[model samples]
Target: MKKHQWMATLLSLICTGLGMFYIGTPGMIIGGMLLMALQGAALFIFFMTLGYLGLIIGPLAIGIHIIGLIIPVLYFSYRSPRKPMFDEKRRRQLSSPWKIVVRTIIGLALFAGSIYAGYTWGSAPFMKTAAEKREVQEAAESYLEQKYNEPFKVTDVDYTWAIGSYNLTAHPEKAPELEFTLSSNDASPPAISNDTYLNQLWGQQLRDRLKPLLDELYPDQAFGEAYVFAGSDTVERDYSRLANNADGDVSQNVRLIVFADLTADNLAQEKERVLELIRRLPSVTVPGETDLTIDYYAADLKTPESVKKVEQDIDDMKGKTSTYSFRVFDISDITSADDIEIRGLE
Candidate 1:
């Protein structure tokens, strides 16, 4: 049979080095087949290493295929004319039948392996175990329950095995308005910090206890909202201690940040009312801790000038000793009404 140069070139374009086999060029055929095998293997490995490894192997596989395509085209164009097409001398120089068969088999095997590898990588994300799916759902439900103080149902868990991550959709019974979808790769949900948990628990208790009294005292609700935070006093100590090795005798501090819409007219009256409210608060005692150092901050959100003045007053009192234990600040200058960072005070 006559070997057509154009047909060989077209085959090479379709499949790297395939044209060389048709053209009866042993050297070009071997080189093209090797390039094709390398490209296939690189692609398979790239899919297997989906995350960061893809960053490396992905480019390598692409480069191999590009080189494979170019090499075959160049070989066909440059060497085809010099070598006799279907002459008896050229036929004698062509590879033996057994050697061609062996090379073809090896190349086919490599190609098949690469395709299988890619298929496995693509399907991995959808092939998560039932137990893994359940774990992801449970994590989402647990997080929602802790956050909203209600029962939560995880509706769906989408596990992506390739990336080793999962996304969960949950619905809180009490809080229907809130979106409770959570995503993570961790085996379990993150633990709540001891200090934060304690602060939130104690804060809720304080709010429940003081709500009625506060409502009666301030009928007009001039005090916007009183949020009390209870946590261990990390400051007021000359020395530092590691979080795990914290001192037991360290005092527990209760800070009542009162958000009040105070104008120049009712500033003094509101300040007095806050002080009275503080005085009425019963001393709280926690086990294995010194007395609670209760402090107050009356945030004046009415005007910027009033806020600035209060800020200056706090600044002046920073180094000086005060007769009163509870302190107050006009946080009008602060944009967020919820911000009440007074613990930084000396």
Candidate 2:
């Protein structure tokens, strides 16, 4: 039977190369299938890393598939019917009976796998019953209490079946909501400790104080966002180090990251404003800490000249007697304006 051109075009449009298979164009069929697979993989990656704006594979994949679909439709529509759609010589080289059968089986298997993956991705979140959610909440609560010595209750549990993880949000009587994730294995505990509580409180206080000042100073250019870090070390080693050195007097290192659209014109004025703010900053009192070693960060001063001037200004300020150690940072090293880090306090 002569293959219908429109049918072939429709099939290809639906599934990259299915139309080629219907037209007995085995070589085109294989190519189309491969292209479809590649598009599917790209889409999967896009969905997986959707949080990152840089990972834009999803749109590219869609474009590629659209082009792929268009190419075959144009070829079938314009090609001379007398010349034949299936290349007999190419078919002999690429698509023997066994080869075609194997390819078909592989394609079916992959299609089934994709369907199964989609089903799992769609159903995993809704699959958890009331009893299962209760169990997960109990486990999370116990884990939190055992780890942090806090009386936290699991208020919400969110399951991401695609990643095989659970995002559990808990609430303490007098504290903010604490969020943690648990994987299927639950091999490692959620990355939270006593310092988490301290950092949260410290950050809130710092933001409340600094935000108003920033708004007042640079109403037009200020972001009014401060990335506050209040700890001596990374959270991973915090609990372990504290356990080993229970009596050690560790001074918490606090960092405040403020954003402003600084330019050459206002550079000097902005630098002086930042210095004055640093001088006026209230001492953050943490356990075993009298004063905070505050580091100020701003991204707008990216040019080498601006950075040098800022550093020089800070050094000149440091030359005089000061109550707290002050450091200035250019935003080049920071990935985001909101990113904050504390290496060690003392």
Per-residue CA lDDT of model 1 for 186-302, tens digit only, reads 455523221132233343444445556667666523222222332344422111221223444423333332334344575456556645554454432222232223333333332
Q: What TM-score goes with each of the models?
A: 0.36, 0.40
For this target, which candidate reaches the highest TM-score against the unseen true structure? Answer: 2
What is the per-residue lDDT of model 2 for residues 110-202, given as tens digits with 9 covering 90 to 100? 545654564455444445666766777777677657756667666776665556556666666456533323433222433322324444444
Against the reference, the lDDT scores of all candidates come to: 0.48, 0.48
Candidate 1 clash pair list? none
Which ranges in model 1 have alpha carbons more than 4 Å from their true place? 1-33, 44-59, 78-131, 138-167, 172-177, 183-346
Model 2 per-residue lDDT at 164: 52
- Backbone clash count, each prediction separately: 0, 0
The segments of candidate 2 whose C-alpha lies over 4 angstroms from its true place after superposition are: 1-3, 20-138, 145-185, 188-195, 209-265, 282-346
